[model samples]
Target: MQGRVIYQEHIDVLIAGGGVGGAAAAAALSQLGLRILIIEPGPAQGRRLAGELIHPPGIDGLCRLGLLSDRSMPGSPVKGFAIFPADKDDPASSVTLRYGEKPGTRHLGRAIEHRILKDHLLETVQRFPGVTAWIGARVTRIEENPDGSFTAMVRSNDGEEIRIRPRLFLGADGPMSRVRKLIGISHETRRYSGMMGIEVEDTHLPNNGYGNIFLNSAGVAYAYAIGGGRARVMFEVLKGADSKESIKTHLGLFPPLFRLDIERVLATSKPLAAANFCIVPNASVRGNAALVGDARGCCHPLTASGITAAVKDALILRDALSESNLDIATALRRYSRRCGRLELTRRTLAEELREAFLAQTPEALLLRECIFSYWRTSDKACVRSMALLSTVDTSIFSLATQYGTVALQAFRLLPRWFFEKTVVDWHRGVLRLVHKSLAFQYAAIRQWLY
Candidate 1:
């Protein structure tokens, strides 16, 4: 294979995977006069429904890449989010978060089709003279030279193996990043149960412009408007079975969790199923190679922050490279220091937030309700939580502050909860609750603070 292969060199940066992250980085870097080679395994446009919700910060990042203009991509404008506890049909039990309510934040999130945004970014990359995009090309392997450059083996569209030697290598290859593995950057990944999504049309939700999440005993159900009388509906399903069967069989397991007709919606549209997953935080840069997007780290999908985080990574990395004279080592160090802090806050919030809503234990259920109830009363809580979810603010201190308020609310409701349960040793129970809350808070904050 080596004897037959053609070698291509003098490339400034080689990007693996031309998804949003890779394409955005190519566009940003090419503008600086660097020759970029982006290998994409998929077709020219993405087809998955995974990354539909672009939070406010993600929109800002797109604008920075010059992808956004006065004329927006075809999608719905999302004002915020609405969360329903247990009974999705009960409007009174729901709490809302509006992005406009937050200070110093963009007023809307864009709920567009994953393919639309991806194609738009790829098109933007093509407009740049220095970017060479090869769709249907896969990166087979990457080798680092002694002088800190890289040689990559790519299987191109016509099944020809080619070698590319580039000054820097970027892995925007998503959660299962081959570049990360080949480069010897260790990471941890776990796929949670599973989730099913269906495209809905001609039906509007109660909070039409806001992403809707319904919490119940079975699992979590989510729906958001995408635009033009269409929406995306997602729900948790049992793991390890035929996804379609799981969806059909388990759809009836829970009560009507949303305003739409569940059976009608599922029957009318094809379902997209995926397992919920988490990637433990790791350094974004290693040696001459660095990772962006899900390659670096991923939060639980429930946060809907994955896309925003990926775009942010690309933007920050572009800034670092531009400022550091294109020195891979210096640029990566700067990116690492900045993204490390952001990753800490994101991981902590994603973990804690998942526990508060999705955990199955009775105690966890109680906490979920308490937190929901707290949000209903606290205006600031709603805005701050939205800020974190939208990635508008990725500060651990700010996260601690918001969660501290939740803790206080939890404590205030504990006594009444105990009294209603007719518990023996109620005082002891309260003390235990307080001790546990403080310990959990300390544990979460300690990791980020250090």
Candidate 2:
């Protein structure tokens, strides 16, 4: 491939996979006057973008990158999250947690079309004379030199092969990243189930300016307003559920409180697109190469932290590389240590939520009741949970405390759970419930302690 390279160049940083993380990395790194080359397979303009919502930390990250301005790109401002917990009897029960309700932090989130956001970041990078963006390009090979530089072979849209050598190589190519594999990094992925996402026009949420999540035994439903009379709805369907069902069939899985908003959106929306909800638990770095975004790791859409994590990765990587006297090994090590810690917190939080609500076992449902009850009755729990979910505080300590509280609450409810289960399964259900709670607590404690 090197011999076949018709063109060759040197870049300060060579990034593969020019999606949210890659594009943002280019934009941020260009500020340091470093030559950056981004090889992306997508068109110059993004076609379809998932993960449209940006939590507060992500918003702050984009602001730091200079992609978010006062006027900002076209989008809606989200204040907080409204969660509708699962109740087989009364699904309408709900609780709203305002982001602003927490002290020392402004309560604000942002929602924008994923495509529009990507284009803005790309355009920002292109404006920098030091950055070169190759749309419709794919990385074919990467070779690490003895001097800690990387030689990457990229093929353009026109079938032109070009080789690039850079002091550092960043892989922001997303979940199925070729760079991650080429650099010999392995990730464990679990695809829990599938979700149906629909984009509706002229649709408004009942809780406007907030991300709405409706949890049920069937699955989870999410609704948030994007800008310009539009909103995005995602439904995590139960196993064996039909994907081709009408919009109403899918949206109906939500509670009655959400039915009107769901129907309004469905009436004006197109057919929903089904996708899998997956998480990659370990997306750490290796050698001179590092992964970011879905490439680094992905979480359940239930958490809605993908966009925020990606933007934060971009910032972390850019800052790490910009440090003085930093060798490639030192820079990547710093990124791994910092980003890995945050990734663990994000992963643990999503796991706790999914196991409590979406798992759908009798024991899981019991756990959900205890967890949601805590959220509804305890203001401190509500604030801390929302803070962790929003990435405002990506610390394991915060995550551990929230789950720890939930575990203790579950213990207090164990007697009631035992009474209810003994009639049905003669203590089997009660034991399962206990096991579920203990497993979560053990994992969380181990993560915190070590």
Note the Cα lDDT for every prediction shown: 0.75, 0.73
Tell me the TM-score of model 2.
0.87
RMSD in Å for all candidates: 3.3, 3.4
* Model 1: lDDT to the true structure: 0.75
**Model 1 pairs whose backbones collide:** none
RMSD of 2: 3.4
Which candidate number maximizes TM-score? Answer: 1
lDDT string for model 1 (252-325, tens) is: 43335443366787667666766777886356777788898888888777778888888888888889998998
lDDT of 2 by residue, 1-450 (tens): 545532225567788977788877777777777788888888644246377888887887787777787575568998778887655466456677766454655467799877788877777777776888888889998877676556788888898887776667888887777888777777787766677776665344567788888776566778888989887777776667765453344465554555676666556755445455564635467656778788888877777888889888888877787674446687788788788778878877887788777675666666676677688777667767878887878877666556656655656666776777633442444566566546656756775675
